[model samples]
Target: MAAPTFTDAVVKAMKTLYPPELADSAWDNTGLLLDQALLPEGTESKQSEGAVLLTNDLTAAVVDEALEKQVNIIVSYHPVIFRALKSLSNQDPMQKHLLRLIAARVAVYCPHTAVDAARGGLNDWLCDIILSETKEAERKVVQPISRPLPESLQGLGYGRTMKLQGPMPLTTILKNLSRGLGDQQHIVLKDADAELIVTGEMDHHSALRYTQLGQTVVTVFHSNSERQYLTQVLKPELEQMLSQSSRAEGRVLVSQADRDPFETIDISSLGS
Candidate 1:
């Protein structure tokens, strides 16, 4: 059988997995951004046949990789073209890639916050992973901080607030979180009240904050998007989508080139 060519039908099928209407924020840009261009005169749609490439961010490197691998579609978890752009030009890196994608005729789709707030989505996945590290005796109650108002998405929400079985010191909690979340992650711990009142350079530099609330210690952990969770949880669904679309073994390729651009630098290493 011939390889399945990407079509509007396939894109529609993919959207059913995480509908754009369920996105947490109204500002989010979800769903299909670009579509496969029509073939030239005398050319066949099958000529554009290729596999799907998944990435958390559609960086220029991912675009080059897609072109090299002959990927017909890109499913980026984050919107590549966000905010109002005055114009598309080489002056901006994102614009350059947009032009490249257009020239190559590759379709781009971003699920964004839809996947984050969807049932069994990113927020839930993150909460599950973190809780998995704790013993059952240690976790008292775990629930979403705020749930979606929609009846269909009752349990789905933006973040989770978990109550420990017993009061734990702020340092101990941070240590446990570090172990679960990984050492490389840049985590900011803040007292919920202080977070609202604090401002200036000191806010950015603080790694951990402690507050006394009688016998209880509470801290909020804020992190940038962790792509690893999305890659792990979404792979199976992506594979199924590909299998159904192509009528073959699904080949969902996660980009190995993806990485967090920010890095923690130890300036102390430099001689003072």
Candidate 2:
């Protein structure tokens, strides 16, 4: 099929997360950027043939990159523009970025918190990654899982529920989760006598109760548990999109990003 129009792809991605009918009132910003007519054919002066730039943080530097690349559509996981707009002064960074995009006929779109909580957005993807098996010497083993990232949360966001599937021991699961979450010390282990449970953020009362009960309960720091969603979910999705685009165009133009910003650890460091 002809590559879906940029706007259409974006709309499809959003609908994947939030059905217009099911979304809450707060998710009003989960849609396209400015109209198609205002967008330029290719970005100029930090513009392109209307390419779309996607990222977790919509910082000034990122905006500059988008302009430099002449991107027509910017699909940021985080909303670059927030708060009520009192006015649009060129002095502010975001305003400057907005002005630059507008001047270049680029349209910036953000798919914040709404996307995170979506079914296949952040949480669901993370859950799948954790459950996936890693291969070693032809043997496959399950890997530990981590929570999604700030951008994914802002873009898609998530809610928590207690049900889980798997037969791994609770202690092993907690350790693996810690590894996945960047080894933050915030995770606490409790001993509840019967069933074990894991919570993303720490709760003292719950910890104490679990400890008293002898259940092996663990709590994850809120920030750590949710920081990798962008790397884990959005990046892969974009890669797939870019890959398909490249194949259809008969060129190796668009490609997957080499690194994820949230994983402070370098893959190169492992061999050393």
Candidate 3:
């Protein structure tokens, strides 16, 4: 089928799949991995097709990868260029990245906190994964990760709680968490070998302790952690555009670009 134009694909995806309610009130901008003008009218070049790049930071290596792949658009979760830019002197790393982006004619877009805070965003995405695995477990799913109440206080730090049921292998659970969160942060899943503990956010001491107990638990940044939204919400929207475009024209070949920027983590020796 003829793919939809990139603009149509991006616009439709953002408007239909990511409703405003899904985004946080504070997040002002959300949609398009990058501006449309950067690429061919509605069509990304062949060099910049397939594999959408996802990342909070748009680093040199990341941009280089896009160039090598001939990707014209970057569907970044975090905006590489936030606020206003007075100059593009390439003085800063970000600026350097931007310079490269413009030179390569790569399109970059960020969904930011809107995607994070969305109803099916990071938090809920994590919760759903955990709950799905423990669907048949003895314990009940709580809903979200809750921080443990202070030793003496009545509530946990963030009031977040774990919703995992049954005795999941520490390794298994942590793997799921890391995968669901896109392995952005290093967390030590504590003596969670045979125990379960929930917290509002990850603490260094707690994370360290988890490692000491032969477990790994670490809380990743809100940005790096939840990336599946692209596939769950963004990609589908892109596909739909292609479907519509095919019906309208001979074929609208629309594709995405890869732009994530975190290096792979060797979880086996995460802290060492």
In model 2, the runs with Cα more than 4 Å from the true position are 1-8, 16-23, 33-47, 129-157, 162-171, 178-227, 238-272
Candidate 1 residue 256 C-alpha distance from true site, Å: 2.2
Report lDDT per candidate. 0.60, 0.52, 0.52
Which lDDT tens digits does candidate 1 get at residues 1-272?
A: 53345545446656777777877555666788777775677865442354678887778889888888777788887778768888889788988888888777788888877776666676666566556656676665554453543342233234444545454455544554455455434444345432121110122323233233212222223223346555666777766665666444435678877765656687998777
Residues 190-248 of candidate 3: C-alpha lDDT, one tens digit per residue: 44343454333565765666567664444444334434555555555556654564332
Model 1 vs. true fold: TM = 0.71
Mark the regions of model 1 whose C-alpha exceeds 4 Å error after superposition. 1-10, 44-48, 84-87, 135-157, 162-186, 191-224, 245-247
**62-127, model 2: which lDDT tens digit per residue?**
766765665556666556655668888988977776777666666655666555456675555444
lDDT of prediction 3:
0.52
* Model 3: per-residue Cα lDDT at residue 190: 46
